[model samples]
Target: MKNWKRRESFLPVAVLLLLVSLIASACGSGANTNTAGGAEAANGSPSAAAGSSTSGADGKKEEKTEKTKVIWWHSMGGELGKAADQLVADFNASQDGIEVEAVYQGTYDESLNKMKASMDSKSGPSLIQVYEIGSRFMIDSGAITPVQDFIDQEGYDVSQLEENIASYYTFDGKQYSMPFNTSNPILYYNKDLFKAAGLDPDKAPATYGEVKQAAQTLAAKGTPASFAIYGWFMEQFFANQGAEYVNNGNGRSAPADASLVNGDAGIQTLEWWKEMVDSKAAINLGRKTDDTKKAFLAGQISMTLDSTASLRGIVDGAAGKFEVGTAFLPKPDGAEGGVVVGGASLWILNNKPEAEQKAAWEFIKFLAQPETQAKWHISTGYFPITKQAYDEQIVKENLDKYPQFQTAIDQLHASKPSQATQGAVMGVFPEARQIVEGAIEEVLGGSKPVKQALDAAAEAITGKISNYNKTVNVK
Candidate 1:
């Protein structure tokens, strides 16, 4: 075990050495300067090329010794990508001391895998936007400098940030990363369909029982509800019932050795979900939320669950067809728990120089500012991490224009701090989520009962956690 851990720890350096040799050999003939969507240095104009010197006013190349360069790897795509790029451009234009290059690196999973390969190498990013589930791995990999270090050194004020949003990125009484785009799951229902089914159009279903009742009524009227079989939803459901996902305070107090996924909450949720699907009240749309969103927009489904970040697209897509109503993620009857924040946060990598890391922190601070956060919220439909952002004129105007978004804000504010809402931390979270998803499919496909499926998934996840702990040398 010690030998294996030693090899695993040394793998990044070995890979880096091989890469350097390959690059040197290639440079002997020619070098490829184009940057693909991976973690290589940002390739483009001189100013955007990370660490490249800029020309002085005298038309002479200057060393740019006083300036710091930061390369940011991100996973945003499409309109969200555009918004992220605009933020980088704004940041670069705001100051001459720091040159930041933002690179879109596909999905979160792909970006994380690429980062794992690039860590401890020159090809790695100075800063990266990692999804919430990757937080445990980021900390365990020892590849990131916790933002708390900078916050403590610089006496940065964090009270202005949303407490619940910030709490997700906080672990062990320290802020590991700066909260950026944050969101929670919300239930989106078609008001028109509810009215057609003789249900209240103004009031959305607030609990699992209510959702099931609504689904039944809507299905009777030829409108079905579709909740995508998302593993995130499964996690949220556990939290919504005030249940921990793993042992030891959901891995916050100590390293988790077992998954609590087969608890009463998990069984209740699966049973409720299975009952709905079994009765044809709800449709199983497989694992893609996009597919469920399409069905909702096309009026084939009346209700769906998705991240609040999808508000803009769904609202605009259903603009003329139907009225969209948003509510808190449904919970079991009398359950007091709330949704855990979704979305990603900005992390400063340790592979970079202290100056570069500081430069990345500066950018993260700028993003946390009220003005920048308000713009980000408006552009991407992501909730701003800063509480002061709500006071921004643009944010106020936006909320007034799209009142549906207020439901998300209200839900966030209503949530009280708890282990469940703070979210679970585990080194093998990505793999565990996949395992849970597979178990859901097993239950829905009648291959296994709900409790049996959950038990199997818990066993699989525990094995993964054990392997991860062993790899990380966690006792």
Candidate 2:
């Protein structure tokens, strides 16, 4: 084991160490979008030339006699946060002219709010990590200096990045933000439960129909719940069915005025979820995804849908509980698309000192290094964003031990990269998802009809998007 020396951290050890108990909630890859559609791409300006650098506040390079300090604000907690801290230490030690300080700023939502506050106070971090859905908000805010500028200037060949992973972070043929922790959802089930239900332990369900059938079998055998129903998994289902979450290709080309999820895919999915809950085959664990995960770990539920990052936690949690297994997310009978990539990316803010921007760029490049990416993948359960990181020995060993991790790798490989898979690129996606979850609750609770619930969500989301675009002067 590589015993990395402890480094500096803004939070006390007790609070940060508490994250170790949090498990790999993998909420990072959870529903960050409306219908599992978030972590949108931002290619920025495709016309940007090589060796370009969106420079200092004055757009001019200035001299600095002292080492430039670059601040990186992030929301990763627990073990992932520790790994991030180690990464910063490694980079700081490897270079002399630049010092990178990583600040753990609570959750993703909190970090984003803090980042905005910092901007208001003229004290924003040079490098900020935002969740996938924050893509549009960050871009529309106009405070980010696309890292493409630094990549072009440094002539850094980003071809080594995993194409599928990069697809979600790229926009307008331009790379806006650098994708960091990327992952997709997968089906997690108990092998023992599968066998008990007379189902194939090795061949997990691949379609909603199959899942329903398996759930029936499991339930008949006294399995309380088969899977957890939430907006994220529904988002995966929509993508699988080649359904769009919003108009204008998930708001990539122009501002989205309405939601497309109110169509066939949406109705079919929610109806199926209602049947599951009604039949007692799937548990209505409410919106707290962690509770559903606990049910699965305790054998109260037979299967669950979650991000690949949560594999380690489930494995650890299921050690004395049951034999856990993984597979691609269950789709509709004949879906044509794939799941969107969830997880966060790194964005460099504009208008900072030229030296600070350059320093921040340097650290971003360092983090993208194959060695660094490998450490990140192994230490945390996030997928490696670079093609080369898979070749690392440590990564290989990690996967070999936890074969469930391979399910996400295969599923991502099989995914057809499209607008549906890239997720919604609207500025208000963060809020849009809340509306989606609420619709799920209303419809599933039997208080509102599926169509009515979804239509209401669509109306609310459209208003939010329209107002957001107007707020940012989109028109």
Candidate 3:
């Protein structure tokens, strides 16, 4: 009986051991199969391997590709500069391939000088914003790549842009730059000052005679009146009187070596300025546009003629201090010549690699889009470069909120190319402006008669032009 019991116990123990071994073998085989399956899933296909490599060790997918850095040199400063920086940041965050770095190079003149110096050292930024006056210099230097070819290669629709804006950048049927922030002179007035001077706050001067009369009225009321008298402001006044400053719309056609600063239009324009100065109704504070703007904003000047781009500054500076009103720059009595467009464009530098050039072109196109243009225009008070941007519902809503924004746009539509005022392209224009400003100072200071001052200016400009032509080899 004891032997039988021992046999039963041993049989039970043997059965239990067999069951444990079977479970271990099954678990090991299943784990080996899973390991093989995982390896096959990852490496069985090229696309699968690529997908797996893009994930982190923790298995999270990467969000963005490496970005390409792009440098943009611009002249926009203050609030406009901040807005431009924000735009760059937004673009960088929205894309994986491009990262734009915006650097302010001071005023247009300063920016041009810096660009020239940088180009000499072959260390210039990949992109630059150059004023219209410097367009010829950029083209002549052969340092800039024609943007038209890139636009074509990228298949961007250039047809949507206004011809006038586009024409500003075109030389010899090729585009050298892309129109960016374009604006013109406009009449900015203080409504409270107008009312205090016994003039209708809503009634802006529509003609040069009206402007003079308004100035006299304002001065009679002991309200100061001033206007910024830059070369372009004087040029616009002459253009309004149907004067051409140069032949062939300032070389838009044939290459011309001379300037017509002594022409009838130029003389008459100077005479009008002389009358304003002699009457003492207009204050010539200084030649600087910013100084005049400051005077206007301080409520010392009832009105000032300056760039439409200055609208934002005036508004922000005068916030809760005065009501500002803007109007089209007045024309001469019964004369109706259109104004010219002013401001700058973006010029892409040559010598970049094809990929970098393509990336730059992409950025330029991105800036030209209606949404982007509208944002830029509203933020900077610059007129939108694209028609669709101006007509968009959002832009309209914003315009309704600030009607003054329409002043520049309306003036731009009335613009036509004129030789005297389309814009000066002389190599010595900077020097010529200093000479002209000196003559203006002489007239305003009562040191010289208007005609004498202008005659001297004309002689000086003629000599300067001749010298520039000799140096530039202009035929």
Candidate 4:
């Protein structure tokens, strides 16, 4: 009986041992399968991987490069911002191995301020879009890598770009940034109002003197002209008259230490503008271009001076109400000068990795393509930086649809390259502009004479420039 019990125990133990061996064998098989999957992944052909590899007809795996991500900080807002975002989306969808994130920080002033604060950290942008006036500050900041480096490396032909537009961003024979949105001030007038005032409907005024006459006629007919007392208009007037805004080649040849705001050209511009307001030929519409644009569209004003960037919006707003007309920025009669380029450019920052900056350059190149520029020009009223964009079919169609746009392109093309037209560059330009606007208000309110207001503005700007030079350690 004892022998039988031992035999039973032995049989149970043997069964248990067999079950453990089967489990071990199954686990080993699974281990081998997992190891094979890992090896396949290492060899760049893992089945679970997507977009990183694909099989060819030759049964070999083709590996894809990982995307180099970049961030673009821009100041574009409203409808323009939307258009910029769409371009980024299209770029991402059209390519692999590069992804861009565009973040709209704020307006030009606010965006620049934020960029300054973020310079010490890794939180800043790989690429930044800075306004024209900020060029001096950007160059002095030493936080940027000149796009010229990439241009030289790739032998990129920049002759295709608009010379006047590129000139604003060029310094010392190097293009510091890529011109994106470009514009110049232009005269926007209501053609229906012009006819009502007995002025030539198709013949817009092309000089300060002619504009004054038209304003008088329009005012007598119960629609006074309105020009926003914007400092940029002041700057444009100086350029249009072939007058420098500062000494030392309009702050291009060297750092400027004084202001030419009290020069003859400045006095002439201010006198004519103040006379129009005083004689009731033109109405003072404060400093916001938006307010003046609204007044013009509402038929309260017969004419206005605004950026060409406002062209599309102005035209669309006046649709079915009145015919809109555009003319080159008016200068003193017989002044042999042209308008300076307004708007902004794209700069690659040094805060990011070299790979990221190269990636940013790639994106900038994409933006500079004729098709992209054409779309941008059509969507926004800003000029296409590249001349080739004008050759695009959409651009041709757009010109046919909105003939007013032709004036901007014509104005840009007609401009002769000069130091004045290349625009004044000062580190304190935004502040200087504010002072100029304040002086304009003082003169318009009859609290100060034109000469006195402008002299005071010049003094103030000079002081600001001195302080800026000190901060930048520029002797």
Give me the candidate number with maximum TM-score: 1
Give per-residue lDDT, candidate 3, residue 363: 83
Better of 2 and 3 by lDDT: 2
Collision pairs in model 2: 35-235, 39-132, 39-133, 43-171, 43-174, 51-152, 51-153
Can you list the residue pairs that collide in candidate 1? none
lDDT of 2: 0.75
Indicate the worst ten consecutive residues by lDDT in candidate 3. Answer: 32-41
Rank by lDDT (best first) = 1, 4, 2, 3
Best-to-worst order by TM-score is 1, 4, 2, 3
lDDT of each residue in 1-475, candidate 3, tens digit only: 0111111111232332332232122222111110111111111111112223367788997754445557788876666777777777667667766767787776666566566656545577788887666665566455667898887776777888876677767755677789988887889989998998889999898876788889888888766568755776766776666676555556556544566666776666666666776787788877667778888888888888888777877877888999999988887677767666677888888756667667777788888889989898878777788888987777898788778877777777776655444555554555555666677778778898777887788787677666544444455
Backbone N/Cα/C clashes per model: 0, 7, 1, 0
TM-score of each: 0.89, 0.86, 0.82, 0.87
State how far residue 246 of model 3 sits from its true place (Å).
2.7
1 against 4, candidate with superior TM-score:
1
TM-score for candidate 3, please give it.
0.82
CA shift at 33, candidate 4, in angstroms? 65
Kindly report which residue stretches of model 2 are placed more than 4 angstroms away from their true locations once superposed. Answer: 1-65, 226-229
- Report lDDT per candidate: 0.82, 0.75, 0.68, 0.81
- Candidate 2: residue 11 Cα off by (Å): 31
